[model samples]
Target: MAKGVWIVAEQRDGALRKVSLELASTARKLADQLGDEVSAVLLGSGVEAMAAELGKYGVDKVYLADNPAFEPYTTDAYAQAITKVVKENDPAVLLLAASAQGKDLAARLVGSLATGMASDCTDVKIVDGKLYCTRPMYAGKCYGEVVVDSFPQMASLRPNVFPLVENAKAGAVVKFEPALGELKTKVVEIQKEASGKIDVTEANIIVSGGRGMKGPENYVILEELAALLGGAVGASRAAVDAGWRPQSDQVGQTGKVVSPNLYIACGISGAIQHLAGMSSSKYIVAINKDPEAPIFQRADYGVVDDLFKVVPALTAEVKKLL
Candidate 1:
């Protein structure tokens, strides 16, 4: 039988990613409910130091697999290592963050283990020793609560959906030696986005724009607001599909899901798809001319005025404070 809650902590260039720590905090919540310990699996070339960091998030065990081949994020290699760890540990629940790398790794792990996987989950709860996962379906038109009957209920959590908590634990590090076969695919090229900004999913504040911005030329307003707040910029699918924003900046069912503390929606009409991505935000502020816009329904604060006039006013207020 499965025993504890396990988080697959992802790392790059020998450092743990923020989403991994977020998952650890999330796993701690589930672990508390199930009366299970929270353990983490970290695989990278030189990441033994990250175990202590994981421990701060309530991880009692840090399973370390250090190897050079694991640094570049080969799907097959990560799957092999993760599968081996899961099989050996036999966890009751396995949680992963729904980042680009995480989704890829989780999909392969689910296929390799033949275990049930609930992807892009916004919330997790334990009822009667079972895991109830809340995930969006049909482009966020509706939500589905799933209960996995598999021995290890594997799930990928949407980034920033859960608040991060730092609980101290004297986690013991365990070393593992997996016989990783030759990877079929090798990542030879790497192109990094040139934004000195934080990862949108990890940002506490997100300023998002939509079609109401009118054109790509008007995006500077949104960017200015985001810059003043030191937060990341997000875009609705409408703006992304219109080529005004990159897909990476998209926040919706077909895009990345976020749960920042403050989500400021500027000129965005709240579509169900867009709402699903950001409804989990702690506080939502909507600025739109249409008073009856659906975005107001989920917004904690709303402004019924033209964005051109309102955004500048808001920006001025922010600049004065700065």
Candidate 2:
């Protein structure tokens, strides 16, 4: 029988991603409920040291797959390595962060292993000795719960939704090697965007701009506020469609979905598609002159004023707090 909760840790450039720790922390609680251990799977070249970091987040064991071929993310290579681990361990549950890469890996692994998987889960817990997962459906119109009866049930936790509990463990390192024959796909180079910027999906705080800014240059205000708060900058679909912001910075049904602790929307008329992406945020603040803007309907705090004035004031206030 499958036994223990396994976390497929995501990493890049030899460093672990924040979602990895988040998954490990969440797995600890679920494992405790199931009377099982939490195992973290770290796969990358020269990432053995990262295994030690997993121990800090309540991981009991770290399965290390260190190899040169795993330098940059190649779907075929990673899928082969992870599929081998899952087949060997037969973990009771597999938890992965719902980042772009994690989503891709989850899809591939589930197909290969022929197991059931729930994607973009906002909540996951053990109920009646079964792993119950909650995920948004119909573009965040409603949330649905699922329980996979199949062995090795898998789920991907939405980034920034689960809180991390800083608990330490021994995190015994176990080295493993998988036979990955030459992969068909290869990553020649990695072109990074917004170097050193916080990942919007993973950030706790986000400051978003929309058509209210009138032009892309006006986004400097949001950037300043986001910088002061150690947050990331996002944009509504309108901003992206207007060619005022990059698609990567867009948040909505057609773009990246985010669930930050604090989400600030400036000059945005919240369409259902836009809200679908960020409605899960812990708190939402909207600034727009129109009182009946759709964004105001969902905002926890609303400012009925032009963004030109409100943004600068908000930025100044945030600077004071810092």
Please give me the total number of clashing residue pairs in predicted model 1.
Answer: 0
Give the per-residue lDDT digits (tens) of candidate 2, residues 1-322: 8999999999986688988999999999999999999998888888888877898998999998888888888779889998998899999999988889998888999898899999999999999778999999998888999999897899999988888897898889999999997799988778798687887887889999999899999988899899889999999989999999889999989899899999999988998999989999999999989998988889999999998998899888877877
Candidate 2: segments with Cα more than 4 A from true spot = none
Q: List the residue pairs that clash in candidate 1.
A: none
| Each prediction's TM-score versus the true structure | 0.94, 0.97
Q: What is the lDDT of residue 30 in candidate 1?
A: 85
* Clash number for candidate 2: 0
Local distance difference test, each candidate = 0.88, 0.90
| Alpha-carbon RMSD, each predicted model | 1.8, 1.2
Q: Return the TM-score for candidate 1, rounded to 2 decimals.
A: 0.94
Candidate 2, 228: how far from true, in Å? Answer: 1.9
